[model samples]
Target: MTNQSNNSVKKTVLVTGAAGFIGFHLAKKLLSEGHSVIGLDNINDYYDINLKYARLLELGIEKNEAETYNNLCNSKTHNSFSFIKMNIEDREALPILFKNQDIHIVCNLAAQAGVRYSIENPEAYVDSNVTGFLNILECCRHHNIKHLVYASSSSVYGLNKKIPFSTDDNVDNPISLYAATKKSNELMAHTYSHLFKIPTTGLRFFTVYGPWGRPDMALFLFTDAISKNKPIKVFNNGQMERDFTYVDDIVEGVTRIINKETAERIQSNKFYKIYNIGNNNSVKLLDFIKEIEINMGKEAEKLMLPMQPGDVERTWANVDDLIKDYDYRPNTSIKNGVKNFVQWYNKYYNS
Candidate 1:
């Protein structure tokens, strides 16, 4: 392990979705690397704020202390970690934060994320994902930030019959509003990178799941329902498949890419890059549930149903670019990943 105290040239990183599933883990990892991290999130009530608070609690920010928006709370546990409760779409406050924090690298993981929820609330997608991203681009442009890495999604490969989706493949056919917003983020990032020379890397994350996972994700929902002996919803009659990457794998890839020196981008005059960060293995929905069931020692009663709107049939990622550049390979198997999640779930909920 690198002794964090002896390291010089520590960059100050601003993680927008610090309270999110991936963001929390990334913030923790960066802090351990001796970088000063300024965590930001709206702490929305999309699912349960309790989970978000719990993640912040792990980052050394208490729920009561994090209630005040725009107030920076330094971490008692790690001096390098601090948090602020703020929305990315807040144009006024967001720029002020960028200026005040002197943030060099930005990881924009904040957004209204959900396929089904976007169907009824399309405006929310435009508000947070589009408008919020635009604000981030503008801030990076004006603030002279070095790199802007934002979260894209595999849903951008919507309706494509190709297996093992690649970053070079065309992503114009987004099936849902959420997918559309993610694609828009990529486009916006490229434009800013080209026009303003802000080096940007967009990660099209597969179905990421593990400990401290989001309650609305498939793995979390399945584990929660099965543990309580409630029936789990099986969409597409258990035929759907997903490239479920573990959260730690995603964080490792992001952290490496953040520090991987991008002088080549300037040499080539292309300051933009996108990569698919995934496990590279697609597992059936039913098989995934089986892993959860085995880990929990409980079988779930599944409610079989047709595929819902804004949902894809399957997702498989081709991580050749990620491995080629950053040498990122997601190594967690579904069984072990599920076991990790179940262990954390039991401890967190005392179930």
Candidate 2:
């Protein structure tokens, strides 16, 4: 971990998907840095609503109290942070939020985020990731947001045999609808940056896991199954690998970009950039499971299965651009990261 760097001047920042794992952590980080943060999420039931509510609970917003959509709920723990229950695709409401909140920086982290789920529910991906991101770009254009930071995905590098996926590498061959939408987000952001001159940066995140993670993610699902003595379905017959970046490292990279001054990022052509934020260390599935088992003090009963649809064999991120620009490097190893997650899971679930 690096020293906490405060923003030169505190600005009003809006974080979409505030109830989600990454959003919640980023919002918390910004608020702790003394910035006024307005978090927005529809609180969808993609995985577990209770888990979402628990994340909100950590942000000091009572789940029952955040009922009204688009209505702001002040955080009980911090004066600078507030949250709202809303969908980003709401065309009419999104613009109103930008104008009313006086938002300076827009962090678009909300999306229908599951490669496999995108196979079954394609419309959900288009509606949220595509249409919703368009709405965000429109709002940033009209309201003159200083900078727009959005989440991209490592899945965009689908089927690439390259060792380390770079931002400069070709990502046109997306294997899943989820990856396609995220790639579309990068294209959309570039267009907006060129036309409207809205400074935008897209981050392609690798497998992010830690406390308060989504239950649908591999780490959380495997942890839960192992704790309950249930058989965990390991896809690809446990022959997969992922550059599992820790949640705090992702947040650190995001905040560094968000706090960057306008002069620091204005490129010659357009104020648009993309960076991959990953640990740069890929670990195999079996080794990752071993770390989890060691942390939990129980070995998982694994059910080896072939790869499912919309799945990839491996993903590795080349974070050279992120390192060169932001001086950010993911430091948390899988051992410590899994330990932290297991500790949180045990305490949160009283298992």
Candidate 3:
């Protein structure tokens, strides 16, 4: 029999924020890969609690059973999936979770997401993104965790005019508090990786959109308004740009990163790395709306507006590194991506 210090070769993976848009997709992919997954989410009322519960239901996790603390719902689809209703900020609870589970890989996806919201409720961002992530990193270091991958946002690329935002670009000048915190997370992760010799990968995700996406994002918001025959706010007077990567593509890129573990310790300076997971295609905001108009069979009543304070004029990604190392392929075109999202929205809401 073979034995090692890491304990059972981490047959199970622990994913935080299993109920969130990206987190839900990530957990689903992990389960599909035949990995025993332990997912955690407090199911906060950040957006609609109903949507969060609905996602849990799709994973074959009973919403009723999630009523308890650390509620675990076995995945009917994968049988290896389990869930917990614990908050990421709960320091006491996390240590218990790490100690109890044979979690080899840790994906920290829990955070109070939203740039505009971060400006209003800075405390929420600090608690979840900073404090919560700290606990996750500490747990990983203490438990001899093999690899830790966490979500960092493209919002971290705030105030930068660099074309196709790359990992080599300087990201210290974040315009919004949300962006600042996200950039801080990258720095924090780097510190832990260097100091603890833990391999960490941070993904600077572009404007990710698709089925079960956040209502606040442009694709979801625009689709919802247009389908209801309502006016859609065209920010920057419809002169903005975004790299709207599809949800499935993002999941595929992330899944590959998980299994292909980093050999160099973050301290190796070579071990710690960041990648921009996005479609190289940057669609103009107006073109994106047009795609929606065509897809939904309704022309949006446009309300032209200047860019929001925390918003940037454009965001493009240079995914050369991602392709070179991981062959990260983001294949969903905006038209198809929007079409898929609208389909899910209509079916889910019975619109």
Identify the candidate with maximal TM-score.
2
- Please give the lDDT score at residue 163 for candidate 3: 94
1-351: candidate 3 lDDT, tens digit per residue: 011122123357888999899989988887776778887888999799889988888777878756553532332223777888888888888888888777889988899999889888999999999999999989998998988899998998888887988888888788988888888889899999779878889999899999999988888888889878789998889889998899899888887878775663443557578999898878899998998888888799999998888999899999999888877777788888889988899899875
> What TM-score against the true fold does each predicted structure earn?
0.95, 0.96, 0.93
- Tens digit of per-residue lDDT, candidate 2, span 70-136: 4532323347777788889999777877777789899999999999999999999999999999999
| Candidate scoring better on lDDT of 1 and 3 | 1
Residue 71, model 2, lDDT: 57
Error of 3 at 211 (Å): 0.3
Q: After superposition, how far is residue 121 of candidate 1 from its true place, in Å?
A: 1.0
- Candidate order by TM-score, decreasing, is 2, 1, 3
Candidate 2: regions farther than 4 A off:
72-78, 267-269
Query: What is the alpha-carbon lDDT for the whole of candidate 3?
Result: 0.84
For model 1, the local distance difference test gives 0.88
Scored against the true structure, residue 308 in model 1 reaches a CA lDDT of 96
* Clashes within 3 Å, all models in order: 0, 0, 0
Worst 10 residues of 3 by lDDT: 1-10
Over the stretch 1-351, how does candidate 1's per-residue lDDT look in tens digits? Answer: 111133436789999989999999999888888788988888999989999999999988888877854553332334788788888899888888777777889999999999999999999899999999999999999998988999999999998888889887889999999999999999999888888888999999999999999889999999889878899999999999999988888898898877765678878887999899999989999899999989989789999999999898999999998888877777888888999999999999995
Q: What TM value does model 3 have?
A: 0.93
